[model samples]
Target: MGGDLSQTEVLVIGAGLSGAIACQRLARAGIGVTCLEQGEWNPRESYPGDKPDFELQALGPWNANPNIRRGKADYPILDDTSDIKPLLFNGVGGSTVMFSAHWMRFLPSDFFTYTLDGVGTDWPIDYHELEPYYLQTEADIGVSGLAGDPAYPDRPEYPMPPLPIQPWGEKVAEAHDRLGWHWWPGSNAINSRLHQGRRPCVQRSTCRAGCNEGAKGQADQSIWPSAIAAGAKLVTGARVARILTNPQGRAEGALFVDEFGVTRKACADIVVLAAHAIGTARLLLKSVDAAWPDGLANSSGVVGKNLMMHPMNRMVGFFDEPMSSWQGHWGQSIYSMEFAETRAEHDFARGAKWNLSPTGGPLNAALYPLDDPQPFGVDLHDRVDKWLGRSALWGMVAEDLPDSHNFLTLDSAHSDVDGDGLPRLHYETSENSKRMLSFMAKRARESFGAAGAYEVAEQTLAAEIGWHPLGTCRMGNDPRNSVVDKWNRCHDIPNLLIVDGSSFVTSSCVNPAATISAIAARAVDRLIHCRSEY
Candidate 1:
């Protein structure tokens, strides 16, 4: 256990999105960095998108839900008491491997949620402070879209033109135009054209399962390889058990299980955690010691509190036109921000974002879920034929207010199914989220009707759509109420940093991949410049 693997200037845990960014930055700065990832690199060709049985595979083995996936890398989160199931892919890319690659920035209003909307607490840093990092991350990860949307403040152009908004999307766009609503071509991490040595998307549309063509900007393709080339050392299948701290209460490194089942201790001057909201919180709570009897850096007793999952609703519009609706990138074609910000007219304090995306293949069409379940046996062919190329979905992501009652806890199991202990997630859909979903779903039906959809069906409060896990470990100016500070440094442990969704102060309605990258880059910039202090 006390060998060559145990020494580093900096030790980064979870070699996913933020971990990749941290390594890349530190390596570029010539800092000695070593990263440990629970999952190994999944080769581009290994993705199931190009395979013949893509649809069947997507439902089971390649599913985004870790409980269903149960891959070698994935650890389960007990969700029997959860309103929405936790969905994450554990690999070099993290959840980006399964994400549809909607690259969105948080609106300026999002930073001052508590002040502007009288609800969730405000973020320590504002959008203007994070804007530069956002631009940097977009360029680094290869985002594609036409800019100059009026929904937010004016911005610069995108790297490439917008991805094709298919016929189904065009209809919705036209409807939004007619209704005088705000609809813009979606900005996505998936390539519209080629950029940074990756192929352009051919639009096979199995994005959630994984993009085999390397068109989507998964961290494995877009971030990690470059980090490795820049001299960062990444060790795969290194499952961290707990963080190691010194007598002075500084982060020394970590204790982990190597691929060969050997318990190893890594020594470092600084430690960073980029493990997602659930895993990062779980890891902290599990890393208990005399100094931190509750959890590492949990002096405020809020390490795993204030969970926000961005509860969602889906509305399907069935058009008479056969537009090959299933063929395009499942990534958003267009998104509406007409109701993104709060208004006094609405009883809810915050808002929801509506994204127009393609529904999947035959199996997804046949088993298409609405408020009422469809029976499997009756008129299967008719159902499939009607839904296959005629359906498009408007998914509403509603921002949830952070609640202390919604939290993550550890079961007292010596070993879980993976022999790595499992975490239990307790969540209840908030009244604010339910109200917002109801209001947005009704508006979605109106938009569909305006788009000339023959029939519109709704799936309100979908349990299967918990994609954005955030706000478990919030950042704030006061150490008494938060886990991290404005710079993402732990208030209790000076040398420990958390640069992932776990540090989010408020849940934004849009997808958080872009914001997460920006946060990591911004935090590391501080770390590199202030290295002498640590």
Candidate 2:
């Protein structure tokens, strides 16, 4: 409460994936926009993968888990109550800084889950409504992929051609064909040919630790530069402590700590929260006031409930010959949707999306912290050599149904210097998710066996792989049951907007970045069109 109280037409919290898109769209519309990001922009040269000793650094400082990295920008997360640990980065690009850049969209059946499968709640919006935005965001983010896959509906081609499938990819594809299962070249955010100013991928296979080749579609590399070039202003190293609301229960702005550790207030006509699911829900729950005793826009008591962290199961195939697996795009060579949609015979209702990815360098095979250690017992050197250039993984991203018990809340046990409670994740893998994982594991081994794998390893529900956290502050029509409406506006406060994965109603099995961008774009477009309504 010391610095000058600032005001902007639009205030955006978080400079991550969806937040960057909201800033871009609002700035493009000539609106005055200011974004406050908890983390500073990381220098491209600072990324570890460029150095000769990259594997050493990737294991230490560049790890995706905030609890492990503990960088200056990262905050502590209480995850002892959770089965699967949540993973995210706290920088301008958010978790995109460390993501494998797997760009995927929800299938048509995904939106109609409650209608068709009678499981989780249905979205107020549908796939068809978001399809145009998906195409637009794909072009904006410079995605690379082949168009006509039988797994999806008719869509336009990607901005660039698909990356090379390599010998390993070809083997997997041929096996899928022989087994009569649906598989297609993976949609990657990396560049095949130079489309934007960014360069093509060098295929270093150290993608999870940031790309030195400037190919992966992290928001910092692909979105923010242009957003800033437009009229948007981005302030780094600003951690929002609380969202402000007026007597009318309308969002005013946010109270945050600046880089210099000074408390400040930023007021805006409209405030947008795009800090992903966990961060967004935490902020809302922490924003309790007199008008809204529980939290801002907590009429439904859904601000921090129904958390869905898209849980994944990892299984790998060890081949006889060298696949040169360390040198290709680790962003998924190909993906199988044979179990993406539910079958009538399935005891479980929804399904999982499986991505085929290359196993990384020798250091990755050792498994210090990245994932569950492969079960090969002794002869460490021999196992590392055997697994390094010979294994490919079929990781299943399973759909997580929303349950109130598996949620996020401020941990009462832990408090920061300001005495504010830290965010804690309380999640349990459901029986349906377990059923999906078990079923997919069997099918995955069969598919790999078809590709002539001599041996296969299974790691059921690894702890360090909650890459897609979603559905905490879900969107729906009824105010009593949901946090936000179809337009991405909170039911309790229309002036307050949430344009992130936190607004998801259902956790689709595929990667959520593409859908997050689409939803952000659509939400901000509506905001621009109806700014006076607020």
Candidate 3:
């Protein structure tokens, strides 16, 4: 399985959400495709939610941080210089295994941020161009929610009904209504009713720990199976070393180390790198040779620049009455996007969406105090129990403006077992982001107060890792300013395509999985239409 390889029409580097969707679309177009995954296959029942030792896994490798959740497939990322550490999974489904399953789409204005708000680079493609693909991706994943929200553009109805609102969501809704702010049940990837042979969500509320019910839209549970059934092949435990190129400066395929530690080459007519933002940038930066000394497809010298992540802040509200905040379901019940865009009165260029996660699990409850002051022995138990059933956590996702200073570069000092350079993230909050966080924090406290919170705790401007990392390898109309073109094809290396979060131009103030899938869908369509170019 290591040494020699068969060349296929398409080779996808990761079996994550983008890769799976790309494989399915390519296969449907009568093209042969194969996926190489660094992690092993994870079955639905393989998730450790029901085990007695599951609670401890959160403190261990199952935590969001790769340094903390060091599994066999995980690679090290250096972040000593960065404020926010990145959290990711290397398996077939990628980070969706630990994601909150929030499936919000980017608004039309998000794509035109540079033109509309005078900040960030504008996306070469617009929302109307990707709206069809977004709808297709939503239907394929079986998203649950009500459409026709006044804040968003006109869109198709969701595949399934919205999840039942919890006590926390109801309180948030009431507060928003009183304040004349807009609120709606968030679009979730978790199923409320059985769809496409999968079971409905049972309200276990442990989605980030991995879903045991196969109801959450992890790529492994959704499109990966469809791609496999369509004759696309997948090879697990294969860590890609670099993109292999020819004298013509076109991508031929990738060189990787198999699970047995054997060097292997997977040749393909075209290659798609969907290893998330950080992994994709690291590989591109490391694939340097005499023909292209700087790096493969890095003629613009921006393969890993302009890294962005949403700066998140959480506000907690406590009540005297016991609240049923521990119900096992999709964590965020309601969301407000009234301030998702920019305004003349605001000092920030972009804004954030506030989400109410009513039932934060025990592990999260225990960890919340780490941001605040930790309580002592007997007081710890009392505090944990008090907040466990009586508090609501509001997550504010502020839009992060991309800066060249905030970027990813390979570390000269740190290398993996295969001797490839490790990714070093250099991130800091911009002045615009700082202003946004300050404004949102005050609004959150006000909102919670309006909801009758006896006491409110604000996690202000803290150093927390962002789940959505984007803009490292951005797309644009010109090769000098971007890594990829509007079609997601590498400007320097036309045969190489990046169909993941690495291709995002802006970090829209919502979870990016939906947009990632939409990009993959649109990119594959372009690939099929221009098949002879590769």
TM-scores of the candidates in the order shown: 0.98, 0.97, 0.98
Candidate order by lDDT, highest to lowest?
1, 2, 3
Clashes by residue pair, model 2: none
Question: Candidate 3, which segments miss by more than 4 Å at Cα?
Answer: 369-371
Candidate 1 Cα misplacement greater than 4 A, ranges = 1-6, 413-421
Give the per-residue lDDT digits (tens) of candidate 1, residues 338-367: 999998999797899889999888888877
lDDT of 3: 0.86
Tens digit of lDDT per residue, candidate 3, span 319-399?
Answer: 777776766464568889988889999988989988888645565666674356876677678667767878887888888
lDDT of 2 by residue, 101-152 (tens): 9999889888989899999988988889999999999988889999999889
**Which predicted model would earn the best lDDT?**
1
Overall lDDT per candidate, in order of appearance: 0.89, 0.88, 0.86
